[model samples]
Target: MTASTAFGQAAATGTAPAFDAARALALAQETFDIEAAAVLGLKARTGAAFARAVEAMLAVTGRVVVMGMGKSGHIGRKVAATLASTGTAAMFVHPAEASHGDLGMIKPADLVLAISNGGESDEITAILPVLKRLGAPLVAMTGNAQSTLARHADIVLDSGVAKEACPLNLAPTASTTAQLALGDALAVALLDARGFRTEDFARSHPGGALGRKLLTHLRDVMRAGGAVPRVGADTPFTELMREMSAKGLGASAVVDGEGRVLGIFTDGDLRRLVEKGRDLRGLTAREVMHPNPRGVIRDDVLAVEAAELMEKHRINSVLVIDDQGRLCGAVSSNDLMRAKVI
Candidate 1:
């Protein structure tokens, strides 16, 4: 058959010849190259406007109010969420909504972050007077410095790009990416200026697992009083089994004469000891203990860090220690997962 006939037959049958992997890869690479070039073009052009925009946001005693339309609105929501979760109190308000009585949400002490790539969004530009009358500082993110929004804004963050990655070059692909990244850059810059800390982030995200791990205290979760499964060093193997079953922590802390932690004897240790076939009835905790178990402090240790220590040592639990190395509490792999730290 002729090559053209074979090609036509394959196309008609919907079972074309082997795909061109090299051509497909080249197309993917070209997209990233063009977009990267666009991002690279955003260099020192980020000048005093960037710094003033951040200062205006920092001076906001109430909240950072984000306004945008269309794709810029979607990107603004993400930026608002990131800023709120980090340190800066912020929220996204659609410009369309602002024009419709939702303008009451904006306070005089608030700072307005307006996003419009073209700097001529009718919906966004239309609301400038409303926000201006409210006495809030306006920070505009725009591609056109000469546009009305940029010219009227108290400060303008230039988000212009050299070209779009779209094949037709009419879509808002590269410009939107640059705008999103620039918005994040602004949020994080303010976060640093505000001296935001991990503890502050935890407070904002308390419902999340990371927040629980970082904020919950060790004393709150550790098994204490009668709940702790403990065995004295002189206890016999028969008594130790009862302790293990009673406590249900998979192991027992072996304490010494002063009720201080000496070592640990776990289920696996019991199995190993039993295999030796010595005298189970007479075996003491001290005799069976595997010495030098890893321990942590009680005061300020993060639950996630405790989980890391457990995984690193390939152990199920660790003894919580104090400045004097006394056992103040205990933690297990179960505690870590329950705290959502692991």
Candidate 2:
């Protein structure tokens, strides 16, 4: 049989042709090119309407209710998560579910963000009249500005892509990429408008490493009270050595009668003094101690700051101070390692 007849038979039987590595590689490269172009295309269309959408979401006293169908629905879920994590109150509602009593989730105080590439998702457009009745302002993210979804919207964000990355030009490839990027842009804008900081983001994600670094304070990781090795400034050098040995902190803080930190004595100092061939007897901590020691930190500062201070000065530990400048605790490099703040 001819090649055309064989090809027709293969199509009819759903039999695949031999795999072509070159064709696959070319298609993958084209996909990247198309999606990248789609995302960059958004920069031109994202102007006043984008700002208006942000303002509306900012002014909203209620959550931003996002709705979409099919692939758009998947993108909507991610958008909702990003918004929620970035300090905006938002949630995703499946368009199909809204017709099935989830419509009650939309309140008059809320602002609805609807997504559809064609501007005419039946599942979304079906509920538009009810959403309007509920008095929530609508924002449409769609490729077709003249579609039904856009017509019903109070604000229109044009996420229109030139074409899909699909070889058949039927799949939601570049379109979905554009939608995702647009959603991220909205979340970023809202976060900036609300003055969301890293600490706030960390609070929203306390289980993450960033939260441990930003939220953990010196007090949380420092050895306090009995755990700290300290002694009086006039204490004999032998007694200071004993304190450092017993506490196993590799160092000791010498304080005054008022519990103010006067100086610090460490193993390094002891070794240096030994190397100098000085008399090893009858030296007081006040004589051997290094006054105003390096790597001092406040208990209220973040643990990450303490890590920075230690790294900057090339010190192994720090003395933690209270508001009145009294020695409250100590933190070592080991402690920072255990806390994973580094």
Top TM-score prediction, candidate number? 2
Report the poorest 10 consecutive residues by lDDT, candidate 2: 1-10
Regions more than 4 Å wrong, model 2: 1-28, 271-282
Cα lDDT tens digits, model 2, 1-342, are: 533344456667898978657666777877899999999999988899999999999999999999889999999999999999999999999999899999988899999999899989989989999999999999999999899999999999999999888766778999999999999999999999999999899999898888899789888899998999999988987888889999988999999988889999989999999999998679999999999998688899999998899889988888998999999999999999998887
The C-alpha TM-scores of every prediction are 0.86, 0.87
* lDDT of candidate 1 over 176-257, digit per residue (tens): 8888888888878988998999899889888887788778776666767677777888898789889989988888888876
Instruction: List where candidate 1 sits over 4 angstroms from the true fold.
Output: 1-27, 274-277, 296-300, 321-329
Question: Could you tell me how far off, in angstroms, the CA of residue 89 lies in candidate 2 after the best superposition?
Answer: 1.3
Clashing pairs in 2: none
Cα misplacement distance, residue 81 of candidate 1 (Å): 1.5
RMSD of 2: 4.2
